[model samples]
Target: MIKLSGVIITFNEERNIEKCLQSLVNVVDEIVVVDSFSTDNTKRICLKYNVKFIEQKFLGYIEQKNFALGHASNNVIVSLDGDEALSEELQESIITLKSNWQFDGYYCNRFNNFCGQWIKHSDWYPNKKLRVFDKRFAEWKGINPHDEIVLKDHRKAGKLKGDILHWTYQSYSEFNAKTEYFSTIAAQAYFEKGKKAPFYKLIWNPFWAFFKAYFLRLGFLDGNNGYIISKETGKITYLKYKKLRKLYSNN
Candidate 1:
C-alpha cells in the first residue's frame, strides 16, 4: 500500500480544526498543519493529536496551501481546509485507493453546511473540488481565496466516490462577513493582475449571478437560506467588480 500525507492551512480555526483533524488522522500516513499563528485555542486543540503543526505568517491562500504541500512527507497529497472534513464514504474510498492507486488525481463533490444545516441545493451543491492528488502532477492555482488544484499538462483526473463535508457558515452575519472579505481579496488579486472591471461587468454580472444561482442552479429548492445565498452571490459579484473599479480609479 502506498502512503499518503494530509495537509491543511489554517488561521484562527479553533472552532473547526479538531473535527478536520479527527477525520484525517486515521485516513493518512501523516498529517501536517500549517497555521498562521492563530491567537486562539487552535494550537491547544491540535496538540491533542499527533500532527506536525508549524506556524507561519498569513500568506495568500494559494501560496500558503502550496507551502503546506511542501511539508507533506508523501508525494500523494490529501488537502483540506481547516473547515472541511472527509465524509465516511470518502474515507473508505481513499483507503481503497491506497492499495491500488490509479490516475494522477482524484476529484470529489463537496457538501456544504450553512448555518447549522446541510445545504442540498443552491450554488452550493454538487460543488466539485480536486483535493486529492500527486504533488508532482498538480499545483494550487487561481485568485486569492478561491484557489484550486490543477494538474500539469492537462492530465486527466478520476472521480472519487464520496463528498467532502464543509461547514461553511454558522450564521448570516458570518456568511456576509466572509463574502465581503472574499470579494475584497478577489478584487485586490484581480487588480494586481492588471484585470480591469469594465462598466458592463458591474451592471450585468451581478444580475446573472443571482439568476443563475436561483433559477439555473436551483437555489430556491433550499428555501430561505437558498434565497439568501443566491442574493449574497449576486452581492459578491457586484462588490468584487465595484471594489476593483475603485482600485483602478484611485491609482
Candidate 2:
C-alpha cells in the first residue's frame, strides 16, 4: 500500500483547521502543516491534531506550497488549503488510491460554501483542482495569485470521485473584502507577466464575467446566492483590470 501524506498551508485558520484535520484523520498516513506564523490559536489547534507543524514565512501561493511539499513524508501528497476539507466520498476514493496507486495526479471537484449555503452554480461548483499528486511527478507553477500543480505532463492525470468542501466565506462582507484583495494580487501578477489590459478588459471583461457565471454557467438556477456570486464576480473582474490598468499606466 502506498503511504499518503496530507499537506496544508495555514496562517490564521484556527476556525477551519480542526474540521479539516478531522476529515483527514483516517485517510492519510501523515499530516503536515506549514504554518505562516499566525499570531492566533492556529498553532495550538494544530498541536491538538499532533500534525507535523513547521513554521514557515508566508511566500506566494506557489512558493509556500512547494515549500510544504518538501516537508511531506510520503510520495503521494494530498495538498489542501486550511479552509478546505475532504468530503466523505473523496476520502474513500483517496483511500482506495492509497492501496492501488494508478495515476500521477488526481484532480477533484471543489464545491465552495458561501455565506450559509453550498454554492452549486455561480461559476463556483466543480472548481477542479489538482490537489492530490505524486511529489516526484509534479511541481506547482503559475503566478503569485494563481498556482497550478502542473504534472510532468498533463496526460498523466486522473479524476477523483467527490468534492473538496471549501469554506470560502463566513459573511458577505468578508467575501467582498477578499474579492478586493484577490483582485489586486491577480492584477499585479498579470502586469508582471507582461499582460496588458485593453479597453475591453476594463469594460467587456466584467460583463462577460457576469454573463459566464449567471447565464452560460446557469448560475440563475441556483437562486439568490447565485446572483450575488455572479455580481461579485463582475466586480472582481472590474477591479482586476482596473488595477492592471493602473499598473500599466504607471509603469
Clash number for every model? Answer: 0, 0
TM-score for each predicted model, relative to the true structure:
0.98, 0.97
Superposed by TM-score, candidate 1 places the C-alpha of residue 186 at a distance from the truth, in angstroms, of 0.5
TM-score of 1: 0.98
Residue by residue across 91-113, what tens digits does model 2's lDDT show?
A: 99999997788889999999999
Candidate 2 residue 194 Cα shift, in angstroms, is 1.1
TM-score of predicted structure 2: 0.97
